[model samples]
Target: MSSTVVETRRVFEVKNLDVYYGDTRALRDVTMDILEGQITALIGPSGCGKSTLLRCFNRTNDLIPGAEVKGELNYRGQKLYGKEVNPIVVRRRIGMVFQQPNPFPKSIFDNVAYGLRVNGIRDRLNERVETALKDVGLWDEVKDNLKKLGTSLSGGQKQRLCIARAIALQPDVILMDEPCSALDPISTKRIEDLMNNLKEKYTIVIVTHNMQQASRVADYTAFFNAEALDNGGRVGYLVEVDTTEKMFHDATDERTRDYISGRFG
Candidate 1:
């Protein structure tokens, strides 16, 4: 940890957050703060609500049928769940990358320019596309082939293109759900490095099962665990949230240690 004191901005404040799908609770009472310009990793077993909570930040949960979110979720001090909140606007401000690299079928240049065009940002469109691609370190490889289909790239490049799509909107935050889970080791490293660089400009929250990936890239980590239900099911809840150092070394919760130690999921 750095000894120097630094001021931090809170981008999202989640209080007693609970999520349900058709009256069944998936996550309960999740309260955590997402700080700006930092990568916060959400790690836990499957069905532990990491992805569920990640989607909540951008209101993607609203897309699912019968999905319900209760309790308080605030973005930049504004009530995120307020009646006046616009899910579309919320999504534009908080972009997301899904587990699989799901690039649009458009050409490389068009893919990066998609969001900008939607937002009526015709001015400097070329510059924005180039910058977003360069930000993800994809321009050098694909600059000459800008018309190539985004899906034609390798898995890693496709993922990078997807990232370029997200950042092109100049989003305040990026939510990645197991971004590197589908790539090879070399490709994973590239995404990890890209993530480390991205935190300087955009706040990031990622849900990943790879403990090493979380440890290597995240500045903060939130470990979630599930409790057994009477129906032989499990529901996830936040177990611990702390700096990466504290989470990996001296987590306050025994369940967190158990999960970290490989004693249980």
Candidate 2:
């Protein structure tokens, strides 16, 4: 039997990525490389397609009606949108955590086990769930209450449970879309800590509106902008891409400086 752990290289490399919703183009010629085992944060004002670009990594954009993608999105050297690429398979290898703490309504155990079961990872279910929960720093707290409803847990735990759910699949990269926007400061801090710990094992890409949060968790940062076209459509553009320090402290673009300095967004 093949080992469940698949050895993949460099997580993703995007080139000239353009996304369109019907006749409206949302993203234009965006390109970047995501190294394996690092956090790359996408930050910008609202409507910059920060979330849209994150969805592209795992081909989540394909689900939208009238949505189309142009250009190369390579995952470990394989073209993600290639004729043979299956989105379900892609999603299994690249998990996503959303803005809200969206834990399933089932028991915590079931919530974590759902992915494994669907993917035929059933033999060591309990052991794997334990390891995953521990990886997200939630094992001890919920060890005795594995059978409890996921909703019964606090907001922080629910988000962690979502993280556990994503990691249990052993994905190559995990995509987070503003995972902390809904949490308290304490909970947000915990999730940020979890992201740091998770970096050693999984490539992380987060889309956030909070510039401070981007600095805290992102190793590489991409600053984006949205252009209001005369046609009443918005086009997302990359204003700058650099290390978190350089982008925040040494930004070249006036817009980036303005946004970071609280002067304007």
Candidate 3:
């Protein structure tokens, strides 16, 4: 008797997704499944819609004027773009950490507690804040400096603070857009290690131009590229997606192979 291993549950199911800003198409027909409790990386060149696609996961695109999205995006089998869905609620469940560490100009503790306060969660607030900080490996460093301003921390600390802020909400999925782009190599490695550890509790999707970074921390990878449209503008689209090992060593698509091999982005 042969027993088949079941695949992990999918967290996000995107089908033929297209995103537009005004008349310009930013991303076209992107379809992918994000598995639960794994790190999925989006790697591509500039103007290739990696970040645009990440925004679609939490409906952050809706905040931009004239931004339109076409096609289906489901979160845990529910329609993410459904009229009945609330963007605020969606964001709460799908947290985001941007390229820059934009911690609020508040105390370190307050930064992590902001979401809890907004959600009206007062019970065990201190405990929650501490746990969040510890989860991101920042508790020991900032435990005594809880009252200090978040912006006063180093670049690496600031990014971890932002991460603590997100994880404090206990979101099921975390979207990161070039999270380590501005940090030193040591800082970048710290973030990558945190990502590896965090995957046990949360599904992560990251947009990165650093091929090595993607290869280091991602379980799955999606490659995207821009094409010149008939209107003379470039529109980004998915090229290939596969297990990180497969994508790096044996991608079926020539474009994916070339991009991963340093021939072209």
Candidate 4:
């Protein structure tokens, strides 16, 4: 995996991105800029395709049979899905952490070392694992249990472990899909704080259903809604994307206001 590109600007500038799963459309012509060193949140109701857009950044959605993407998605000014682009290489630069804490059925140390091992990093595996665990605020608790199975940890600890795993890969950006939906309130708050701290070094994009969570940790928020079409599937659209404060306080779209104010999902 490549380290952060040394720059002083946005890492991603998505332009008129459209996604289709065979004959059904998943995302509309969505355009947004994800600034470096900031956390961007995607919030929408269930089945609204918030996760679909997130997957586009790393081209994960393409793995779905018949799924296709249209328009430009630039990363560091380079088109992400360009003909010469390799999805495996793209994923290396942009790592993803899913909703559940899915650590390998190995030792805690090995869990964090998996990425390093795959990338042929061997000189300082212990040090890197320690650094990532410390960053996720789990080092002190599990330092003595490095040899213990990762599955032995509690729910909160497991989630933090997964986060540590993501960071251990040292990707330029981290995409999180409902990272805290399964954890307790305390765990969720800790993860939120971790995200705030991680923004100093990582560009974070999170897909969350919790509006309050978006308001709390995101600097920018994109609100999405889906309209069920005559065909059987739904089509997702971006209603508004703005600074979190502005979107939450003074949204120009009536639909955005209604959704944010809890009038409708």
lDDT of each: 0.93, 0.90, 0.94, 0.90
lDDT of 3 by residue, 1-265 (tens): 0011046888888899999999898999998888888899999889999999999999999999999999999999999999999999999999999999999999999999999999999999999999999999999998998999999999999999999999999999999999999999999999999999999999999999999999999989999999988988899999988889989999989999998899996
User: How well does each candidate superpose onto the true structure, as a TM-score?
Assistant: 0.97, 0.95, 0.97, 0.95
The lDDT of model 3 is: 0.94
lDDT of 1 by residue, 164-187 (tens): 999999999999999999999999
- lDDT, candidate 2, 38-150, per-residue tens: 78899888888899899998988899999999998999989999999999999999999999999888999999999999988879899999999999999999999999999
Instruction: Give the winner by TM-score: 3 or 4.
Output: 3
Ranking by TM-score: 3, 1, 4, 2
What C-alpha RMSD separates each model from the true structure?
Answer: 2.0, 4.9, 2.3, 3.7
TM-score of 4: 0.95
Off by over 4 Å in 3: 1-6
- Ten residues in a row with the worst lDDT in model 1? 1-10
How does residue 246 of candidate 1 score in lDDT? 92
Model 4 per-residue lDDT tens digits across residues 94-213? 989999989999999999999888878898888999999999999999999999999999988998999898889799999999999999999999999999999998999999989999
Superposed model 1: Cα runs more than 4 Å off? 1-6
